[model samples]
Target chain A: MTPRVRVPETGYNFAYLDEATKRMIRRALLKAVAIPGYQVPFAAREMPMPYGWGTGGVQVTAAILGRNDVLKVIDQGSDDTTNAVSIRAFFARTAGVAVTTRTRDATVIQTRHRIPEAPLAEGQVLVYQVPIPEPLRFLEPRETETRQLHALAEYGPMHVKLYEDIARHGHIATTYAYPVEVAGRYVMDPSPTPKFDNPKMDDCPALQLFGAGREKRIYAVPPYTRVRSLDFEDHPFRVQHFDRPCALCGAGDVYLDEVLTDDAGGRMFVCSDTDHCEARREAGHRGEGA
Target chain B: MALARGFADPVHDAQGAFRAMLDALARPGLVQALPAALAPPAPLTSELAAIALALADADAPVWLDGPLAEAPEVEEFLRFHTGARLVADPAEAAFALVADPEACPDFSAFAQGSPAYPDRSTTLVLAVRHLAAGEGLAFEGPGIRGRVRLGVAPLPAGFAARWSANHALFPRGIDLLLAAPGRVAGLPRTARLLEA
Candidate 1:
């Protein structure tokens, strides 16, 4: 193992960013945390990587990362996914920090979507890569309009859109990128994570930071902060359910992704959270596939 | 000799300070301790020094008020270490250091930021005599679960009313970090000061 020192072995200044840049991001992060669910605009620097591909989360992680931290990166719930693998490798090379796929082992976890099934501890920091931080962007295209709306707390349009979804479909058809109200004040877009991962955000133990590099936005949900998915009495918010348990790990309660086995209708359910699945399997969890 | 020096371990110390400030600001009314306590010049505690080192950089302008401003060593230490430019006008400062809250300027005197960019507002790092929970003020907002009582002694008179008006500004208002010796507490614009 590389010595957990300030200087990275890769010759990059700690975490691949300069001290000034880190301080700037850290200041924004502090503000972001203070005003939970409010998107704080930051001077998003031009990182080595592109904007959409976890740059925001990477910047956030870089700013907060210490020499002793164990880092983890997951893309769409899978640690081995292409995006996840690259991000994990990037940090390993630049930060020279210990990298882990296990949720329990990681002190800082940067994820694209799907919160880990294993509950996060108090000190852990969860950095989320957000493509669009604005929850009202789709409804109100103009940034000025959205800013005003947020200031006035006029989230009636958001409710109207969801209400319309119910009117069009039998229920609120919005599944991914579901809007949630943080601290009963600011309506926040909890990234594009499956609505299944939405409930995990409520009163969570770990500090949650959302970063959008292209959007130059940073927001946070501090530990134990109240976060409620936007919904009404008539049309309550519900997570997606699978009839069958995970075919590999037998996780019935965990979020599952349905994968087609063949060209035919043959398919199988698997835990969306790969770390959770692997841990359960190692612990003697069994399923039909086993 | 310079009264206060920079962190012994720049990388590690700054990281630790950043994390502590992050935790403190994230959870308002909760007093988080600084990792390393260094005695700065008069009025400025080690906690505030640690914060300024962690947050301020060459790109940002910081304002010092009262005795903290009068102390040349504090300015020299910050300039030499963090490379932060000290500004005279509070409105131009990205960060403001206040040794005495009672002698501090009105909350509106600092940059409240524009409607488009709320993050542009100044963050006040004030030296306080007391930073604990008791009977002073009740805080309820994003960070606070139900309501958390915070007591900060020697706060300027009519601070509650001032804070209420500041809170009314919402997205465009100054955030505060109250530093007392090794402990620090934050009061964001969102935190509502409930009336007694």
Candidate 2:
């Protein structure tokens, strides 16, 4: 047999979650898929690691990863980012799965902040880290009350909050982490990505899963889940940007991460989604000292 | 140095830990072993840490008091693994883990539920040597539907009276887990304790 070939005890598919855990997770996954955007409360387990720092994604990957899956983990949309690298290293040791940097090459991608620039294909999974699963949580303090609000489909407070923002700041000053109503089902927190990424959530083909370790909540968006940004009709929803091309890739269509290089306030904006930008660069691309 | 990228997770990933915890809580005064165990402190066994770790994360602000309060190892362990926030006051905490309940902060100091919504109450993790099992507290209430005797080791000073006050608060009071080395007995705020 080849060096990589293994037996049952040592061969735990990609991630090391047991079959029972995978079965339980699979049941939850079905519900999430059926519900679209509702935050389904789950019993998040303790990994070798603690909560917060990717327990949610870890569990998801553990349950979903099969023997031949290629796993890619990214933080802030970059594979090189510290947290992303750490998670990658963790899976390499525990799950023994092949890791990839290119978005298209991997079957599953776990991401924080920026989403992939390249459109994800069907069958590819995208997981997100959710700080707070309840979009109405900031407005409502109690879980029971929030559950009632969801049951009633009462979203007056969210509209009021967005309207108030528009009333105060010109053009909806909220940058990232904008809220979206999924498929008219449940209002979901699209992780903490700047509102700029909000537009990317609409009508996606790949599966989107969100996990909140601390809050004990998890939710999902199946392919084609209609994600409407929570905004007033008068003000409408807005994406944040300078309307400029990427400094590094000279790509005008991509989301840029505005970076401050010095104390004198010289600013440079690079593509926030590195995978897309790098792919573009590899195809014989150049930019303005970007 | 562990990096924390709370990337997206499947819906069920978060549910596994929660279901186990809820099961543990529902069975009040029963022990539940966690899927993932960890190195814990003297008072905190692997089981306690596992429960705490599963429930407590960065989103869930945690408060510690008494012996385990602010211990660097514990704090570091939580931060590294879960990215759970450590709060100074008991009132802000979602889960309050105490080494010794007797020397712990006042139960009233913690966040109790308001009349409008009683589930806003905090869940307390009280570590004791042994729970006086099978005989002390005459547990009565919604889940129990009748009286069941529960024995606990000597509680912290005035614990019974304080818990009585907690019970008096009903859904407004804090939930509790009287934990020991490897086992724990859960008591949600809804449970009422009568003399066995």
Prediction RMSDs, each to the true structure: 2.6, 16.2
What's the true lDDT of residue A84 in model 2? 85
For model 2, the superposed segments whose C-alpha errors exceed 4 Å read: A1-14, A262-264, B1-196
Q: Is the docking of candidate 1 incorrect, acceptable, medium or high quality?
A: medium
Candidate 1 residue lDDT tens string, B1-196: 8346778888778998888788777777877887656766656677778888887887788999978888888888888777889999999998998877888899999999776577788999888888886557899877666788888977866899999999998777989888877777889898889988
Where is model 2 chain B poorest over a 10-residue stretch in terms of lDDT? B3-12
Q: What share of the true interface contacts does each candidate keep?
A: 0.71, 0.00
All models: lDDT? 0.86, 0.67
